[model samples]
Target: MNLDSFEQLAQRRKTVKVLAQDSLPTADCRAVVQRVIAAAGWAPFHKICSADHRVEEQFSGIEPWRFHAIDADACRNLRSHVVHREAAGKIPAMLASADAMIMATWLPNLPAGGLGTASDNESFEPTLGNVEHIAAASAAVQSLLLAATAAGFETYWSSGGVLRSRELFDLLNIPTQQRLLGAIFLFPGNVTKSDKVEIAESKLRAERRPASQWSRWVEVKQ
Candidate 1:
């Protein structure tokens, strides 16, 4: 795509929190979701060094990040949990309104000792081992969101507290070793255009720092 077209696409992409309660017209929303996810899989990943003794001897293995798409019915099932109960009213509504919710998870490289003591793991900076994987997964999510935008879908990325609960992991049949990054709700855009008004109002009420405010060009003097 040309630079102008790319810019337009970037400008058009927006987070849609409240989706209209309408099923996507397409007979196969799953297929569309799969396509978006496939596009996401194209994101570049930094390979973990297998040759390093620290990794080869101490670490188990690295698994690629994965995505799971949950439909409304499954979302409803999640409401039974206490963790989900507090947001029960809103959570169900959001789930019911959206066509599907996609979850991104990071499967960490376990220690050779296999889930060693928390203190032992903490000292080793176990979280740091998955940094590259998380970074790649984030890029994949961005690609998925952008693809959904191009397909004329409204999308919302949410890091709801309930997502971290063990109940959700069991419900989704996600492995205990996997850590959820977040969920992306997808559905048809608001036809009444009221959502856009809300978005505009939100932007008006918030102050966003421009790139110049946070970025700097570094110069080195030898």
Candidate 2:
């Protein structure tokens, strides 16, 4: 890939959703995920993530983002767990079709020893650090998305419905202080585009207006 193709690659990226059951899951896309995650490290971040939290000990202090990737077997286990919980709405279909799932999380700078006291949604108190952390993580996620796109894969960034639960955190061995940024699901491009599987494109993609409509130059005050 060349710098000139960056615009084309960006344009080629789109949200493709596949709801197939255990079809493309047979492919091990973790290598693509690993390379893309390394590419994601190149994303810009204004603030360095704190490694003081027990959850962040494994990674560099500079990265606010932490990715936990699960393979097909793990996906199947998670699928079973979700089904057993009776909250398996669209999750099972996604997991079944995914070659792998990335549980992307961001470390939040919180009050000292405040993990015990969390909101109803298990989120921490907002801080300037929290905002930057999310931004950095989101940029990293976008880099991964584009990398996956370049690798001939279809990706879905989901809001992680039941995946944000405390039980899941414990099951996945994720620290409680980390917050979910995205539940990235990867599918084989061929399978996703094939007539054999049912695929759904994000309707919001077509609804996007031109850049001029959503962006503008800042006015200068004399």
Candidate 3:
């Protein structure tokens, strides 16, 4: 609740990618993932839910977002599926290392007189409701990342790569109308950052703009 603690939490979170061979015990991963999800669910959102999506009862009625999680064993299976299917793009090697991952999706509010059959080509509806829904869902995704970081687990917010494909969607049984926002990976079992560990870090990770450059003071004068 304190500002200092919040600042420290923010500083601790970062994207880290590890090789497929690196992994944590399934038991530790499962427990840590549960806590991480509990933390993520606390993110604020303006709207409650979308009319089209059927959210699980266990989620406590949060409607804009839905998460499909895969454990370490599933992660390995997905990695195999990715390679076997030859899904294009920079396939993640960390799939082998990750103990768990959640494919986070947002429900898009359809326009008036429009059906909910959204496709990849249909990026988004230019409606106010849709915008708010997307933003809320995105907030939930950030919450997931922060929660994972708070657990002292290595996390990666991936752009979804093959995880966004139709094949994967059908495999996970995620509803078609929902849009994929992020693929969050969690490497548990105290995977501390080490110099010897070969990780996939962004080259621009160190380049950060100061707050003054990114923010400004505004005033309305008579």
The 0-to-1 C-alpha lDDT of every candidate, in the order given, reads 0.61, 0.80, 0.73
Backbone clashes in each candidate structure, one number apiece? Answer: 0, 0, 2
Candidate 1: global Cα-lDDT? 0.61
Give a tens-digit lDDT track for model 2, residues 109-198: 767866546543366657888898899999999998998888888889998888988888889987777889989987778873455567
Stretches of candidate 2 off by over 4 Å are 1-4, 22-25, 54-57, 119-121, 192-196, 219-222
lDDT ranking of the models: 2, 3, 1
Q: Which residue runs does candidate 1 get wrong by more than 4 Å?
A: 19-27, 48-63, 72-84, 116-128, 191-206
Error of 1 at 62 (Å): 7.1
Alpha-carbon lDDT of model 2: 0.80
Candidate 3 lDDT tens digits, 1-222? 799999988888887877544333454377778877877778777886655455455544656888888888888777777765565344446666688889888877765565444656136677777778778878888888888888777788888887887777888877677688888887763555565345666667789889999999999899
Q: Give the best candidate by lDDT.
A: 2
Name every residue pair that clashes in candidate 1.
none
TM-score per candidate, chains pooled: 0.74, 0.89, 0.86
Model 3 CA lDDT for position 159: 81
